[model samples]
Target chain A: MTEKSPGLFGRLKAGLGRTRAKLGGSLATLIVGRKAIDAELIEELEALLLGADIGIEATGVLIGDLESRLSRNALRDGDAVYAALREGMLGILQGGETTLELPSRGKPNLIMLVGVNGAGKTTTAGKLARQLQDQGRSVMLAAADTFRAAAVEQLQSWGERNRIPVIAQHSGADPAAVVFDAMSAAAARGLDVVIADTSGRLHTQGNLMAELTKIARVARKADPEAPAECLLVLDAGVGQNGLAQAEQFGQAVGLTGVVLTKLDGTARGGVIFAIRKKLDLPVKYIGVGESIDDLRPFDPEAFVDALLSGEA
Target chain B: MFTGLSERLAESFKKLQGRGLLSEENIQQALRDVRVALLEADVALPVVRQFLEQVKERALGREVVKSLTPDQAFIKIVNDELVALMGGQSEGLNLTGDSPSVVLVAGLQGAGKTTTVGKLARWLMQTQGLRVMLSSGDIYRPAAIEQLRLLAEQVGAGFYQADTGSSPVAIAQAAVEAAQRNQADVLLFDSAGRLHVDDAMMGEIKQLHAVLKPTETLFVVDSMTGQDAANTAKAFDVALPLSGVVLTKMDGDARGGAALSVRQITGKPIKFFGTGEKLDALEVFHPDRIVSRILGMGDVVSLVEKVERTVDHEQAEKLARKVKRGKGFDLDDFRQQIGMLNSMGGLGSMMKMLPGMPNVGAEASAAGAREMRRIEAIINSMTAAERHKPEIIKGSRKRRIASGSGTQVQDVNRLLKQFIQMQKMMKKAGKRGGMAGLMRGMGGKLPPGARF
Candidate 1:
């Protein structure tokens, strides 16, 4: 296993190595030789932004901003484009809250994790639960994902390994019923936090996604202010479709924050801007790797630095 | 999955439909639209640029005819390029050489790597009639091995458990030895997925690749990922001798840019696709059907194949005969039709094949799916006598069904009216011929305002 790098920014830089190579390095080379800011540079920079999966709407906004700056005689050289691009990216991500704000002291802060299938919702729930536990808060897990094969067992395995109590029903049970049970269990145990792992099979129209809303509604029965946070776990590679998922899930169950997983891979994580700009939801954390402690709080400045910090 | 692209291209071609000749400016304009579509679909920027360049050259130099519309010609050029970009035909696993052919599955984390292993194992065993064995090299996750073991047990594949204390290379080598001893026809190694492609993980995979000398090394990726899929596949291709690709989770709302981009970027064929989470959902990648589907032409062949595989022929023939004899279609028939649709990957997938419905967005499809489920639930809640005799179902019965199906009373009334209309249409077509006539008759009833 790779040890955690001492610096958070260093770990982030390493994690974003692929995106840096494709977007940052390419952008630097495209602009390095050119003295004047021209159509070619703008076009190549546009390509770079789109290549990073910065998305059409956001890229258009960034390029438009750069073009306006260019027209105003604000642009000087290649380094200017690089700085402008960094600043443009940061502008979108900066609006969202970087740190996870827990609910008022004594009560258990409930966070219902949601996303499409294979978006790392379960793993993120487990990691977040463990993180809260390590921070001296008593944490319990709700295995609300009883549909998928081995899903309940996966959550239970995390609970057992981390020594956190997991409230779960047998496989094929109603997920809402499972969360209800977990809520009761958490209240009885006097746990400080309850992280519910909701089903990610939102594409299944009828009962699977309906169960998420039901879980949220029932969680309130346990505590009026329950489910203090609803985090949508998005895979970094989800591209523009992440917007659709966020919109759908956000509208269905109000999203408090977003968790982008698999960020350490080839995904440029450009969807971060799209999610922030479109949904206006803060990215609470990013999953850097498979390790338990790899879950890091989202730091927009650090993330932007890691993303565009490439030498020509 | 490529609905967005198809719709954008449709719009672009509509602009060119007025023109007779393929002018350079018109071609460039349409190519620009194609470029945007590809970029939006998540095809890498560079690939999209190059693809549009080739398309531009071809479209400008094309020989136009009197019969073909300008739009049709443009679509043909685009379709041909798409088919060429993907490896032109379906490429299955190359497992002829080794007795226990080794297939190494590698990908980033949460890219459906482990699930693909199980699906591929099941597909090989059920479809190819091969004895399959499964092994997991993902020692990082505590339950990774257990998850694969359970999947193997569920699928009835041979399981070669790796020692958790051992390195990935050691585990893979031991699994290969066990597979040989067990006389398995195929051994699938499920390697660990790093959150990112780090040197350590790549080095580990490289070592495993050296020892296994696998027949095929498949890079599994999530289809929802846009340009990243191509980039990631290219990165992996640089380090390993990749045999092919596996695009997973086609069941999701992915625009399917990865399907278009990965092939051109990696220069490898996509061997299989994971349509759903089920073990039987793995399918051979068919380039022609995909190209047609992407071009908004609809994949009739795949649609027909799906029907043939899932629909009961004898039952269908019996129903056709019954309808021909003037016997009315009932709730039971309705249930069976809905069940058949469910079996053929549900309404969303079916809509992708029907003409003029390729670009059905997620919300509309979700509604369609919900409607299917509601109708099925209502039918299940019906009594045998009520199902057979709709005349016996009055207001009270309708209420009961509505409550039972968790739907409104209007829903029951709507369904019954729709059923009556369908019976009338089926009877009218039954006089002409069999089910083909029924489909043709139904097509004729589509609104005049409907556009392809």
Candidate 2:
């Protein structure tokens, strides 16, 4: 445990340190320790988890699991404690490694991007478009976010750089009609892929959410398997709140994958663990920078290693 | 625990509370606590320093309220300063532009760009009665186009998609053409986002700007992104000409530092805020209301606005003039004041708007309902003539009024004593500056009373 190089797990270790320190005071002290597990320790641990913003429901399940482990006399020293905690975490984290796989055989695998405003949905879409293009696929972009004044202009700029087509509408035009036109064009042109950029909206807003559902329905109607994948982009810096957004948007539009953006920006990326554990949503991509190539496909072992190892 | 924050604040306020006189040392210590709290809440360091400097300037030599402790007076000053720092009034989107005005959404990846598009679209269509069209220019992710299409349909707006071979610029140009052809009033372009602000992305966005010059280029940033959000906004400001900002994820447990920082750093008014992921969760940003909330005070600006709308200021002034002339403050006038206060979110909420007031939960405050009713009863029991002249009520009248109002004699005596004391205090304070001074005094005392 050198002071300087705490490895890839430095931030996680540091976050855990602060959480533990905050937990060390008053009521929390009575709940967790190196000694035998007790009711006090369980209650305190529960409080500690909730205080860490791990959320209420997840905290309950984690406490229950810990208690069962304790009752089986599986309690041990600090390393064992850490191992048990990791095991509990892994139960939620391990199986969600599948990336957004492209359709095996289709005119162009249409990947529909979605999320709340500021969730980096646009950036992730651009990065994913660039990534797919890099992988030797003919990619087309549809600037379906016709609501914002310069959104289409910005997306058009991305299209020019990538030498791809971006279907767009005016600043205040019908977004659904634009997508319908873009998809029809993509199908007719025999394009290998079409990535549509949607406007940022709240998952709870009924009308906007209904609009998203309608877009999916329309895409499917155009080609029964038109939207091969629906990727929900999220900000890594959002912590637990991002997970809640994921849950809502996932419920509303049926997310096929997730893109965790801004990994290089913050240390509180433990949200990945929480999202993986709770929502069971696969991390399809990881956005590291502003460059088009910065987007990379999700690799669970690499991610866990990078996160746990604390490497840049 | 959240109580840690509140307790720390209370301790600071305690230092400024009841003192025969306030010392410079006490003020410094209290300011130090406030600084620590602000910093801990993730306020930008520079903003905190600037805020502290402004507060220190305003607080020096200010008279402490007569009834309040020194801490209470200091807290009032600090609260007012905080409200000013956050901007005096809440501001909403200025959609008062020409029809089909362009509102550009810009931000880094994970900044909630797409969601804001939908929110703004719905707001325009529902609130402004404009036809909206949504388009996406993110060709990188195949799903991005489809996502925008789905959102457009959900919002009851038109959508567009381009062939992979066609350029995004061409698609955007064509989309604008499409909107013109359809006669849609508002066109929203959910532009592509990058992870970091890069040259290529900037050049590309700049090129798009060359083609379609939008009316408002809004930089969408995540409030939960903290300092990074501010930095990103700066980066985007350099790359694009931003007209306003859209802050998202405000519903999170953010101490609201980013909101303050973004406005201060960019000099751009926050156009809208995304409270939740719901389309309607988007709200126009109002600086004054946000300022009040940050100071742990309910929105006083709105309260004052409500009062201005409901209460006749001329009538209140006339009543005050009569009381000053020793004409006797009457129950009817008091009743009218109570009615005005009730209309303005009740006395409890008004009190919470004052500085140093502990935030009483709704349930605990509701427990005081009986006390309010008792006070109302005591005032209602007096005859019109008796109500007009408090001096006419003798000991027998007090007993009769107490019995009539279903209370003991002590209750009536307490009310009269309070009224007389208030009258004397008002007279001593003088006419012109008296009410202002009273309001300032009330600002200090309300906080301590709120604890009960």
Q: What is the interface RMSD of each candidate, in Å?
A: 3.2, 10.4
lDDT of 2 by residue, B48-121 (tens): 67888887776675555352666667777777776565554445555446555556677766567787888889
Worst 10 residues of 1 chain A by lDDT: A2-11
Candidate 2 CAPRI assessment class? incorrect
Candidate 1 docking band: acceptable
User: How would you encode candidate 1's per-residue C-alpha lDDT over A1-312 as one tens digit per residue?
Assistant: 564332223447465433433344444567754588889888877776676678998999999999999999898988777778878888888865666667556667788899988889889988998898888888899888776667878888899888999988887788778777877787787788888897667453444566677888888887788678888998877888888788878777788889988766656667778888988988989887767888998878678766554221
Question: In model 2, how large is the Cα lDDT of residue B132?
Answer: 83
Shift of residue A46 alpha carbon in model 2, Å: 30
DockQ of 1: 0.49
lDDT of 1 at B58: 75
Model 2: lDDT of residue A212: 82
Q: What lDDT would each prediction earn against the true structure? A: 0.78, 0.64
**Clashes in each model (backbone N, CA, C under 3 Å)?**
3, 132
> Lowest summed lDDT over 10 consecutive residues: which window, candidate 1 chain B?
B443-452
Tens digits of per-residue lDDT for model 1, B1-452 = 67777777878888888886888878888888888888788887777878888888777773455437778888988988898998767778899777789999998777788889998888888888999999998887657788799889989999998665988899988999999999999999999885335767777889999998899999888888876776677779998899999998887666788887888888989888887766888888898888887888888888878877777888777667766755666778767776767777666677778777777765666677667777778878889999998778899999999999898898888778777777777677777666675344334332211232
